[model samples]
Target: MSSATRRPNTNCIHSGTRIDPAVGGVNTPIHMSSAYLQPNPQAPETCYPRYMNIPTQQAPADKIAALEHGEAGLVLATGLAAITIPILAMMRPGAHAVFQADLYGGTHHFILAEMERLGLAYTLVPETDPEAIAAAVRPGTTLVHLESPTNPTLKIIDLAATARAVKETNPDAVLCIDNTFATPMNQNPLDLGFDVVMHSGTKYLSGHSDLNCGAVVTSAARMKAIRETAVNIGTSLAPFDSYLLERSMKTLAVRMERHNANALAVAEYLERHPKIGAVHYPGLPSHPGHAAAARQMRGFGGMVSFELGDSPEAARAAVQRLSVIASAISLGGVESTITFPAETSHYKMTREERLAIGVTDTLARLSVGIEDVADLLEDLEGALAAL
Candidate 1:
């Protein structure tokens, strides 16, 4: 079947492959070569690793393009590399962009620290609705970047409306979304009219917490620009990791099903607990963004953020009490983890800055894993009771 018609699970394993003519291997072989045969020595990067044209790299990238329904895609060594390269490529000096206020701390910090030094300008839209995003667009805006089911807060953006917001406000501006929290199985931003979709493959895409990778998928024209920037910057995914990324993605759909189910169960339980003040989960109707999230996403995703007591100390103590869910920084692994946003992802943001976007000290993000629901619930109950 064509990639477009293939079911998601089938596409995960087969979308990027061609029948092997060499050894009939089921998987893409890692090409460790630093060199490739150059009939015209001038084009030395025709099939080089750094250029992201090697078979191992292309296979997974092609898989992402197929899964995301984008014309092209690229994988890189780290999520930051995938995200920063495209933003930098699109917004040169004097250009401006509008960013969603609640973003991955790394991305948010990059804009704050580098935009001025790089001679670019940006506006942060506090509200996630399409109207608010479009209102922030400057006259010379070259990009509008946002995340749906936003980090730490779980605020959902209307992808279709947001894409329209960018097109109507600044036809020239590119709309990019960080789809890490909403993996490809749950949402495909490109189909919603987004210009580009990027992900921290270190999270959901890797699933196992073993690999650190990233991806950017967009139209062929836009990808050419981003790929050129990546080639120069040399952040392309190495062959071995590229191989691992593809291998890992084969079970993405399977894992996400469990993630979605467990997260909703956890969110429901948390919402009922007297110790938890608020539960931020799109799967729950109580969430302010539930309607928007339901309209845009196939699944509400595995992440659930909730209030733990009223202080950072209480949040820290609660995480420490969890014997099963390890306290960790990065998330989206097979093993469950709980961490305070104030201490990890958004720690760099000042208390004032963090609170401005609803990332309070009492907020703790639970990355619900594929563990048995009963066991996970017992662990959480123990933690909350301790707290």
Candidate 2:
């Protein structure tokens, strides 16, 4: 059967596998050669690692593009590079962009600190409402950026509504979404009219936290532009790292299933705990964005954020007391990890800036792993008791 007709789980395992023509090997071999031998002087440029369209890199890129339902993809060295390069390519001098207020701290800093230097104008919308986004657009607006189940806050934006509003307001604008939290297993922004979808392959895509990689999925034309920028900036993924990412894609569907079940279980437990304040998980009925999430996503993702009722100090103490979950900065690994976003991910922002986006000092974000749900509950309960 064609890849388009196969189930997602089937696609995860077999989407981009290419048999070795020479040895008939089941796995695609990593071509570590820096340069391919030129057949003749008149031939086109030969394959090189930095070009990143070689077999090894293209294998994983192909899988990700299939998962996102895009025509093409490019792999980068890091998540920030994946996001930044695309912005640089799409928004030229004198261009304007509309961005969500609550964004990954690194992305927020880059836009506010660098856009002016690049001669680009931007506005951050405090709310994700379609009308608010429509109001922020300018005649020169070239990009509309969004993050659903937003970092640490789990705020779900209405993608279809936002895309419609932005496109109607500015026909030339391109809608880009950061699909790190939801993953292609749970959501595909392209299906909802988004122009591009990006992922931090370091997190869920690798699923083991051993590799750092990023990917952008979009039309062939957009990818060609981004690839040109990536080549000029020297931000291509390494050959070995691309091989690892390809191996990880084989289990993405199964891993995400476990992550979804584990996260929902943990969210329910936290919601009932007396020490917890608000649990920001779209799977929960209490979440403000639950209904919209249900409509757009196949499953609520593995990420959950919550607040302690006491103080920031109490929140830190609980993190220290946890026995099973590690106190870590990143997320989406097979091992459960938690972090105080106010101190880590959002630390660069001022206290007022963090709170303005709902990342309070007392809030903690958890990246649920594919572990036993009972053990996770016991570990969390022990930490809360310590607080």
lDDT of each: 0.89, 0.90
For candidate 1, write residues 94-125 as lDDT tens digits.
Answer: 78888988899999899889886787889988
Each prediction's total of clashing residue pairs, residues at least 3 apart in sequence or on different chains, is 0, 0
Query: Which 10 successive residues of model 2 have the least lDDT summed?
Result: 10-19
lDDT of 2 by residue, 1-387 (tens): 866788898888777777688898888798898878888878776788888868999989988988888899888999888898899899887788889989999889898788867768899999978889888997899898889989989999989988888889898899999999999999999999899898889999999989999999999989999988999999999999999999998999999999999999999999999878989999999998999999999989999999975887778888899889999989999999999998888888998889999999889999999989999999998889866
Q: Give the least accurate 10-residue stretch of model 1, judged by summed lDDT.
A: 15-24
Each model's TM-score? Answer: 0.97, 0.98
Clashing pairs in 2: none
Model 2 residue runs over 4 Å out of place are: none
For model 1, the superposed segments whose C-alpha errors exceed 4 Å read 39-44
TM-score of candidate 1 to 2 decimals = 0.97
